[model samples]
Target: MENQWLQVSYADLLQATDGFSSANLIGVGSFGSVYKGILECFETVVAVKVLNLLQQGAFKSLAAEWEALRNIRHRNLVKILTVCSSINFNGNDFKALVFEYMPNGSLEKWLHPNVDEQPQLRNLNLTQRLNIAIDVASASSSSFENTNHDLKPGNVLLDDDMVAHVGDFGLARFLSEAAESCSQNQTSTFGIKGSIGYIPPEYGMGGKASKYGDVYSYGILLLKMITGKRPTNDMFKDNQSLHHFAKSAFPEQVMEIIDPRLLQENAEAFLDSENHNNLKNKMRDCLVALVRVGVSCSAESPGERMEMREIAMEMHAVRDLYLEVGIQ
Candidate 1:
């Protein structure tokens, strides 16, 4: 059966976004520009990603995204509404993708809030963070069967309810049949596929993209969410990295490295003596477990990393524990 996707006309999108006006442009990336638009036929809000056909890599990315999105269906994954391929008024080749608009935007902006933004806008509490983590984990685990070569904060979008939806499959690729029979020493033909900070260590040595590499990238993302620090943070000098920094602070010193906003949000709950310090203890335990999972999944050796199945189960358990403790 042909893939179930709407083939929208270029004129409708032009009308929707007022000819892709600058005011409608919401995001710009290596592949294309994303504009906020409302499709009049359906009366629905959508994100229109118009690919830059002039860029050599954009064509491959467009194909990869279409192939991956058409084959996958999961609650935590981004939903594609339609696609457009045609010539523009200027007679230039145009290719675009329309997606369900995510009101809350990317996880990157929320985690590392803009300096000029209001303080109230920057906070993401422990419970919300845990929920987002679970959402991403579920998406990652589901996508492992047809691995996403790129997994990072920028790719994680939040809906109106703050539920995370993993998007951007431009670099995705399924493991080839030959890969299953090849020796471990053989390098991947797909080439290096992830953003700098999230790339797995083995990929540096010409390793192939595998479920393990996705896990490593997810690990880095998890650590970044918890600590409010990117893998490329300046503090990670003298052989230190986000992974090692988080690993070293495990169990005892977790709070020291944890996002201050998270702590501040729950300060009153921690101060409640009637709970008999139960909330505090549960939070600490949850943090320790979460950090351990991050470290284990991002292990320097791909062979040492935990599988997504295990990571998913453990993360769900952690979220359950957090909810059970009633630490709001």
Candidate 2:
């Protein structure tokens, strides 16, 4: 899509925004503030992502944003409808991106299960999780998915429809001749590059992100969904990570505690089988499948990866098992 500089004058934006009042603020991000805006053209509702001007190099974020979304196609990836600029402080000129509003906010907000959200929507179900995974998997394998480096969770977006769409391509690169392209999961002692809780230990080992890295992060997200926990320096202080803890227990019942909204029937299985040991075995197998995918993709030894296409196929198989046996 050709980039359309915003049609409304920057002056008009100031008037409509009441001098950029905090009330208009939607979310604060690494770049800048996001505001809900109504355009003069169609009176359309949109999300305006504004980056810090004082930070100066914000243009790279814009280029990265553009690189991430421009030509690629996927229902799971957010779509940028237009670009706009606002004059604020001399150093911090406002650079903004307008997107179709996502009523659900973000997976981060939902995964965290905060007070601001609807009590009824406390967590995402297996189908919802799998659907999102599938969406990301599809994007991870797309031509745009081919990045020199890895993808970050911050780049992923969920619309009001609950459809997951990945955005922000600036940091993404084609799987290098040897890498899986992403990983942020790291040990508490050492932080990873992107989001803290999401990085992999291998990343702490100075390894690059790969499909496996994404897998690892996905596993963490799964654990978060199942446990309703947050990442902290002492996250595992009780000697349990959402991963190890979930793996150590029975998912059939306790897993419901992870995401208050999950029905007992939904936690029964993921990759398949009611024939495993404790919830540990069942979950171990499921996560083993997941971690295997993540590890293989992130293997410093690149030859080990199953490639994005294979990764997507494998996830589909696991999802089929969930749908066939997991519906509550």
Among these predictions, the greatest lDDT belongs to 1
Which residue segments of model 2 deviate by more than 4 Å?
1-8, 15-19, 89-92, 116-118, 148-155, 171-193, 201-216, 231-233, 237-260, 263-306, 326-328
Q: State how far residue 133 of model 2 sits from its true place (Å).
A: 1.6
lDDT of 2 by residue, 1-328 (tens): 3435446555555555556678978677555777777665667777777667665335666666666566555676777777766566554466667777777677666665558768565567656776777787787776644453234444556886788776654332321211332242322222333356665556555465455565555555545544556544365777555555554454344433344455443344432545424444444345345434543443333454456678789888767655544332
* Per-model TM-score versus the true fold: 0.91, 0.70
lDDT of 1 by residue, 161-265 (tens): 999998887854422222344454442433333376887877655565678888998899999888889998999889889999988888789879887888788
Candidate 1 collision pairs: none
Q: Output the lDDT of residue 164, model 1.
A: 94
